[model samples]
Target: MESEQFRRSWPFTGVVLWMCLALPASAVAQDEGARLSALELLIRSPQLGGSDIPRDLPGPPGGVEVPLRADASTSSGAAMAGAQAVSATTLPDAPVRPSSGDASTPGLSEEMSPGGPEGSSALLSEAPRTGVSDGAPLTLLPESSPSRSFQVLPAVVAVVPGLLFHGLAPAIAGDGQTARRLFAMEGAGLGLIALGGVPIALTGASRRTIAPLYAVTLAGFSVFGISALANLYSVVSPTFDPGVPAATLPPLELEMGYQYVSDTSFDYDHFVSLGAVARLDSLKLEAVARLAPEDGNAQVRFGGAYRLLGAPEQRRGDTDGSSLDAELFGLYHRYPTEGFIVIGGDLGLRGRFAMSRVSPALAGSFAEASIGMSLQGYSYPGPVSDGNLHEQLLYSFGYGVWLGRGGPFKGEAMIFYDHRKDGFAGGLRTFGGGVVGNFGLRGRALLTETWGVAAEVAAGGALVGRLSLIYALGGES
Candidate 1:
């Protein structure tokens, strides 16, 4: 009897222990279910219009019931009222979730609902939004939209049409100011060409008019070349500064050199040449002489020029101005081997016009025109011919350039026509000979502060070339 009672009590004890273990597990499961339900309610509340909670919703393993909210009726009522207000004020384009039974709303999709499986996938796959405001859509441009490249068409225009059109390239590039200036330059060039070309054609290239006509022709071509270069430069480098300061010459300068004459009629071949100039305010005095040491052939000229119009000496800085001058000169020449001597005086007026203001490349360049009358007396040896006054007309038109600034290495050059037929070659013409003309070029280069070289050449009755070493006594070097 005692053993049976102990067995019965053991069974009961084991049953009670199993019940205690099962109770705690059921409570833990209930707590987990409650938390999960709360989270689902929070997520779906806004999209669902805060409707009543479903009674048949499944719970955890313990079958516990969890309230959607502590004050479900009041909270749901307030949330429903807020939802109504939002629906009335929201933008028409805003996305909306589809209701299971409602068919009146447009643009509503079940996939957009918070509780739908597709909604989460769509959110994950959506592209990132630009930071632009919804009212204004963003505009996009290419990455290289602002990049620039040089165009070959402009260069072609500059070289082809540019030669004759002057400013066509700049005009095509939309630079009106440069175009106008280039056009004006072209017009001037064309005018000069006409001025030079017409006379040469009319003269039939006669030697009597060849010298001055060639000088004019050369000047016209110079203007044309400058215009062409300017056109190309304007197109290629629109922003370049093309300016050179006006150069000033000093009060006095002296030069000496050697000369070589290549005259078929003269016996002298080599000469010593000397020249000097003195400036006194508006008056300039000049002297030049050449002697052939071997043959005793010699020539000397002394002259002065008085400024008559335009800027004064003190205003030499105005390089782009005009000037008029009155000139007077006396000359003496002897040809011992040829047995003759000549003495003469000339009076003339000179006009100078500067063109640098029109083109930078033409800086320090000037056009000059002179006209004069030379009264001369000729004497021959052995009393064979009597001395008589002869009248000769003198005239020239040419161009000159100051090569550099008034510095150590400055220089100048001139090309001119000499119309006076009064030398030994003139004597040949005087005796039933052909008409004559002379073309001459003279240049000087200062190699140092006080030392330089000089050269001159004349072609007409004779071809003469002179080279000399020069020393500057007083100047603005």
Candidate 2:
């Protein structure tokens, strides 16, 4: 009877031991699950002001801790209570026997411990220690808040006296970086004006230095104008996007158009023109022909250009960064009434620079310059007419903007000076028949990917206008 009683007591002892081992594992699993669920709820809650959470919250002693705003503390407290209740239900009915002080009390609510649910609730009620712990709530100003009232004043100032004071608007607005750049640009412009103006004045505006001086003076004015515009733009629209989609020129293009000349000397008023272009890697070939049907006059030009510097052909896009090119061209002209023919060949250089990096308002801005020398032979109906070759210089410089990259509408506008004294303008003479230069405006706008229109107006020796339709055969859409 003694051996049987010992055996029965052994089974009861084994059962108690098993309960002690299982309780802690069950409690750990419950705690982990509760923590994960609470975290998920908190993250999905819209009351936390989107996803901008504080990064410096302190971790709890044995688990993760999330700092809660004052409005969220009540709901979080309820969640902690539910987690404690669930942990309690998982405990075994028989009390877990503690071995030394190492064993945790089974079925004792976590909320009742020193670092318990109440302690966490108290911590949550206080603002996060990162920055808002001073008892004041965190508040963000609205986008159109009254504190930004001073912005409009800068815009007004930028428009009035700001034209002369390039950086004043940005300086007043506390943008030192932009202000410095604008002031530097204005200084450079002033320096250029002085450099060009003083010499011209000292020399009494001699004809020999007039052209170069005029160019430098004009460049200074352009710089001033651009800087003034930039100042106004910076204050009025501080956050404008200057990005244009990358675009590339096509391999082939075709164009046809009509031109109207308003020359007092020429009887021919209308002409039809055809043009074609073939582009290869770093090389371009082009041909153009114009005919005056009533006057029986015609002109034809052929040319090829090779890129010497800048990005390669494969890298060219709508925003062609910068490029320098050399070209060789030949032209043939037939005059009806004058009964003369002219043939010429020219060698030239062309360069373009993009200015998008300077300012958003001038995103598509570009400057171009071309210079060349042409050798020509003239023939007339009379035997005394000489066929000797004559040399002529050709040069032009312009500034413009490229518009509508990665869009249906695409175009360019430019104001330029042309030094050629030919065509209807050649017959007229001023100040002892000296050649007069031309000032011109040219623009081309495409309505869609395949078709577009162009117009040009020039005034100087003679006034001229041209209109045309353009089609792209193969290129960027």
Candidate 3:
């Protein structure tokens, strides 16, 4: 019984021994876990990964601390020492546990940490930072900036051509009637001109090309129309041609002449009479007062009519540009053609040069020079012989100027041609020119403009001349 009880107690004693030996392993295991936890904290913290920590490691097996870093290396000395220590233990044969120590002597770890090496490797495999933290791409704009007012390169395209039109319009208007019609035409055409500017202002377009085009078109349409109208109203009517003004009064001219073509081809015939032309038309009817010191000349013509544009219907856009004095006037001239009350059912080319110094400001009078052309057909020529004084050729062109410290009077110098053919009718050429310092005889003025009247005289071959009165009119401004 005693032996059996000792045997049973022996088993209990073995168990107790086993528990006692396991204490060291248990304590070491817990310490490792705590160490690993601290290592993980350091790894996760950005500050620890930078220059925050100091290196303080001891070599291998006998070392107290373990290396938690994934790339940690151990020394051979640490491994061998650990093996010898295990062999030296005189205890029963059992499995050896890991030292988990620094193992710097061997340059390796006793046991591999799960996922540690792989995780670190993956983190490094990622590409380095190329740009900002968010990591996105960049973009550039098409048009760099908003345009300035003068940056209209597109408008320039149309503007250039438009400018040309504006400058050349007056030179091409031909006559007063035509100029009036031009105003209407341009008013309509400008609608298109303005459109050219829109694209450049609102959309993508060449600043140099399209923008200029629009600008030029606007300039051309406006200036051309205005210049043509001005030229027209400055030449033929006795009343103020509300259309345009001579700015300053021109000089005065006076002359007369007579013609008779006893034959169509001979300068040898004997038929000559007196005639005069003191004004001409360019594009619209003009108002001019003139005097001819020749041909026993003296005449007066006035009406409430202001030199103005004909209604669209009256002018028929297709106006045969001709002088009022020489062209076959419209239905208005047919009631009994002649004088103020006589309806001159016909056409004739009347060219004249008249000027005066009745302008208050005459410094700008150099522009008073004028030239004109006309076409007229008469129903009857009572002065000659009623056989329908038909065919007419008329034109006037020249330079002139005027001056006045007093009133606004226009003075001018010009040459002209009048052609005609009928049964006893004749075609003659008149040469010579005369001057009249226009007196305040006709209703003419200019204010910011002024106006006045004057007479003219011309003598080419045949001593042809005229006697008449003329006037100028413009804005009170």
Report the number of the highest-TM-score candidate.
2
**What's model 2's TM-score?**
0.57
Off by over 4 Å in 1: 1-247, 310-315, 358-361, 381-387, 423-436
Model 2 segments more than 4 A misplaced:
1-246, 312-320, 382-388, 423-436
Give the alpha-carbon lDDT of every model: 0.60, 0.63, 0.30
List all candidate RMSDs to the true structure: 33.5, 19.2, 38.4
lDDT of 1 by residue, 1-477 (tens): 244458879888888666554433321112133333333443444355554222221112211222122111324453354344333322224333334332211112344444453443233223222344432221211123232234567669988867778878767876676677768867876787788779888988787886566556555665565566656655554333223223444566787778777777776778888998777878989999989899888999999999998654434663454689999999999988887788999999988766444444344566666777788887884554434667766766665665655445666677766665665223223354656457778877767767778887777777778887877666553
Which ranges of candidate 3 are over 4 A from the true structure? Answer: 1-389, 405-453, 465-477
What RMSD value applies to candidate 1? 33.5
Per-residue lDDT of 469 in model 1: 80
Measured on C-alpha atoms, candidate 1 has an lDDT of 0.60
* Model 3 whole-model lDDT (C-alpha atoms): 0.30
lDDT of 2: 0.63
Q: How many residue pairs of model 2 clash at the backbone?
A: 3
Q: Best candidate per lDDT, number?
A: 2
